[model samples]
Target chain A: MSSKSNDKDLGVRKIIYDKDGKPCRSCNTLQDFQFATGKISAKDIQHIKNGTEIAAASPQETILNSKAYRRVDPPGVEELGRSSWNLLHSITAKYPKSPSDEQKLEMKQFLTIFSHVYPCNWCASDFEKFIKVKAPKLNSREEFGRWMCEAHNEVNAKLKKEQFNCDFWEKRWKDGWED
Target chain B: MSSKSNDKDLGVRKIIYDKDGKPCRSCNTLQDFQFATGKISAKDIQHIKNGTEIAAASPQETILNSKAYRRVDPPGVEELGRSSWNLLHSITAKYPKSPSDEQKLEMKQFLTIFSHVYPCNWCASDFEKFIKVKAPKLNSREEFGRWMCEAHNEVNAKLKKEQFNCDFWEKRWKDGWED
Candidate 1:
């Protein structure tokens, strides 16, 4: 195909490759994964054009958001992104104050495996990079929570969202204001 | 506390205790966490009374649904439940068929840690029980996916929701119908 046709075919999508160098739908939510692969609905296209909110339309009640990272019928990028953060953050929020060495080691292993098995290859690598910059602080809940907050804030900044004050990490994650 | 007052305070919520036996907000969304602890808005109370759809009130973008697990501010049981399944199911959906022994072991280890660090102690224990009943089958993607689907379906059944057709697991998770 001509370069122009290829560009036309791709539209605004940036193809992310999988282990086999094929377009990885799990990796690319918008470009290569969602629209390029014909996963997005016409309504989604309208939302993208108008910058409107995209609705997550999974009827399986998860499959609860089970396929969030895979297909539009199931979830797609936004749902996966939304849900993964929830699971990851909550896991850290509940980390023990003084985790045992084995616990710490397991946490490390979990993150490593998590980064590998995460459906979105590109996202998995990003998480790996995020962990590398400042390794998981497993000494105490406070230390680990702080590390996790900073890492999340970095992600927030990248997404152009407001950064949460890390000081309230406990209140935000573990305790509500009433506590 | 008077038994009558205690019951009144408990409201329609079922308090699920943590490891310490204290009311685990992580486990009980309605009883101990969201409303009993005063996390729910007055509007939420009205909705509860009216049986309307409950809104997940987190403007944090994520903390993409992170605190969906631990707190109502970020997310709550509903958010957490929805997201966890998404993350778990997608991971399984993407599992490498004929995975190396190392991958299977890692997946198993991942589940063990996942259950351990899971914020909701009740849910975590329940997940452990689920595993005990039908251990994870890791030989192939289909086997693993089928096992995961059955597990999720069991959860759905418990929640009084419809069971997913296991045959459609791949279609629902990895590929949309158009493909």
Candidate 2:
């Protein structure tokens, strides 16, 4: 574990695969991510007798080892994706029915910056292409929200996740289903 | 559980506690969120024999029962928070070392819209206050990243979680911590 050079320490790298063929931390599951970043080697991991060997091991090693998520590690791809979608859907849910020029511009800029700076390079590239074709329907909240739903469905289709019913977009994203 | 009215079906309600003293689904853990959303009543939850009782229960009953998250429901507050932070930190991690006037403006707009339309109303309100006190320091990626670190630290302090060392924000957020 050679320390990063001073010049490289503060610089941020894109969330992509490493040259060694390991997936980036943010792009894999927590356990895979731990392996990806060399936190635990494939050999050592297979042999990890218990949590005592884990670096800076959490007190509740049993729980941490058993859980799919650990608080100490950064989120992986699925987690990040879900979060981004939640933020995006929630935003569009409240988008004004009639937005001002500034609001529209800001919204456009937000999406632009969002997809551009999205950490996962591969996901960002796909998102960039997706936005290019779909073109944000920014005229009104309804249009924008509908567009977002369709966009989400497209991703869901590609991922083999069930297509969410677009009709319930607003209800699920903004309004909780009435019981 | 009478279904919502026709007029209310498509409406997106703010994420908040319900009149029945249940926290909104997005504000609690999966089990608590489930309880809150009436998917499982408190009594039933306490007495549930198996996954059969879960609405459209997943096949992995034991796994679903013990896990902190479920795919079927919207993200809870903590999940939402972690995801939002991933998006925000990653964005700033790549923000240009020195931004253009337009870039600066867009960044500011992004934060504004982000806070304004954040899904968790209570969290949003606190975020708004945090930003107000911190005021986004968006001159460059370095400044902005530092600002974000401080902002996150403030939240961590409030939540009683340990404060992340800002010095390594880039290493963690963008570049994988050097292994």
Candidate 3:
């Protein structure tokens, strides 16, 4: 009798693998194991702590915009942490209520940095090189620092001239952002 | 005066209506639309086409498995037509290559449709209750048909097993699915 024909009799949704098939990738016990997502065959279930269970006991304050340098090309950053904040910053920065060409260029530059923070165009300097290239004419670093400081002011000046609702812009600027 | 010193002299890249001097979405335009691989303004470019253009004098045969489609949510069938032909059937079907569950599902269903000349699921059916479900299932109709046929065969005959190579499978089983 085929194992497929006896699916109801086996008391499972479906047998993940054929009987007497490949050995387990995880635990040495090749007989019993649950399949995980990503379609990888495994012989053991790795214990991952789900936050819901811990939430009731500890009520810990969640960290916002936390960085995990350990993770490279990590999945679910938007669902798990600061990706939502970053996305909002980008949308607002790029598509401000109203924008001018200069402002757009600034937004575009920042977006480039945000998307890909690679090594410098000249040698191997990091994001610092990006900041310098974006605002090149400055003789001193102090002026660049001032520009970063009043970056919001420049955005606001463009927005005011475009004639968008001031109250809305002020509220968003003051209240911060949610997903 | 320099364009920076006097905004009116800035030409196309000049700021038009700037309020808070923030990133303006409306007024910004791509500065290097003339160059390849540079920023192209969203507003300027139009009429993108994907597919080979043959001369009227002599029509050339299309390369096997060359199709193009846009990417979107619940992705359109037209979008996967090229991928279905090229990558799915041409490559994987020949070798019995193991693909992800999603890819497997796509190929299996595509095979059924590629062989069938009729698009509708049912040729003969009771009509009284068909008023509510006017259209036959679009996504999984072919899968359902094959499953039904296989189930019927299993119930009637004790066994039907066949082993064949990729060339035989492509030539005999798949209709109009060849170079």
Candidate 4:
């Protein structure tokens, strides 16, 4: 095999193809992979077919080589999940102990809008379903905290991760554990 | 100094007190420091006061001792910022080039609610002011992307970080660089 073909073994391109041999762009992790190598640039495609190894660098490696690479790269689903959870739990921790009616309404509205706009399409859809089934409890801080903890546990279950101890919700997020 | 008092020198407790000597829970990094040593449990408080260094251990250390410590801890502000940026940019990258009117409305509503409910109180309030002055442009993907980049640059300027090149927004977020 040519060095260009050998580059596929490096686990860079996992291009899934349909029966007609067309690349399924959605199946690719790096969205622009097709555009980077597709018909727009026949010369580049020819370079690849000519067995040139230079055309085989992974999208990530190509990005890393860019001068602006140090600025910041877009976060994947996992990173988004972690950051979102941190923001959510912190908000719960700071929630008022005896919230007013208006405060409760605002909190509920916030959650509704959050579900609608959450960047991850699949995750957001799942969360919308979850919240619709079991609406958020915004009565008091303790109730809200526990409700949020259980919601998180639901996500953990879906992700096949271990469920957190809900009893220690405050201890973990708000108050530190008593050693 | 006794071991209990010595715990103070360990920099374990970074408590902030108000004018009345009451611990300002909001000002403290780790909550429950006062509660762990306060009068609610004289036995626990006395245990701390009686030169028992073990009783004075912070929750962070206690968590670090746990097996799940490596799994995840609450993200700090910087980590949260990085992850949030990632999610926002990725969403922008995936946004429809010629979005429907309904899509534009949803995006605007999402931003409004997001600004209000952003976990960081100060950051959220600041963002609220920002959106009010410079409303989100949802006419096209390019307009939205450039607007988002400029908003991020505003934040970067405030944080004294280098501004990103908006011209390369698509290249950095949607497409891999041309090597």
Q: In order, what DockQ does each candidate have?
A: 0.41, 0.27, 0.01, 0.22
DockQ pick, better of 1 and 2: 1
Candidate 2: which pairs clash?
A175-B12, A175-B13
Highest lDDT among the candidates is held by which one? Answer: 1
List, residue by residue over B1-179, the lDDT tens digit for candidate 2: 23323312223223257434546554545555554455555445535534345444222222223232223345567777877888888777667887898888877877876776676666777889988887999898889998998998888888777666777667666655343
lDDT of 3 by residue, B129-163 (tens): 23124322223424332333333233224323332
A58-77 in candidate 1: lDDT tens per residue? 32343333443233355566
Q: Residue by residue across A76-127, what tens digits does model 4's lDDT show?
A: 4566677677767767876788888877887887787667656565677788
- Candidate with top DockQ is 1
Residue-level lDDT of model 4, residues B1-179, one tens digit each, is: 11234445444344444344554333333323344346234344455556654443343443333444322334434555665666567667656788888888878876786676565455676789999999998888888888888888899888777677788787666553644
Runs of candidate 2 with Cα error greater than 4 angstroms are A1-71, A96-105, A138-142, A157-162, A175-179, B1-71, B97-102, B160-162, B175-179
lDDT of 1: 0.70
Clashes of each: 8, 2, 22, 0
The digit string of per-residue lDDT tens for model 1 on B1-179 reads 11224444335455455565455655665423555455565567667677897766433343433443233454567678888988888888789988999999999988888878787777787888898788999999999988888988888888778777787787777665452
* lDDT by residue (tens digit), candidate 3, A24-56: 111111112222121212212221112222112
Report, to 2 decimal places, the DockQ of model 1: 0.41
Alpha carbon RMSD to native, model 3: 26.6
Error of 3 at A38 (Å): 17
**Which 10 consecutive residues of model 1 chain B have the lowest summed lDDT?**
B1-10
Q: List the residue pairs that clash in candidate 4.
A: none
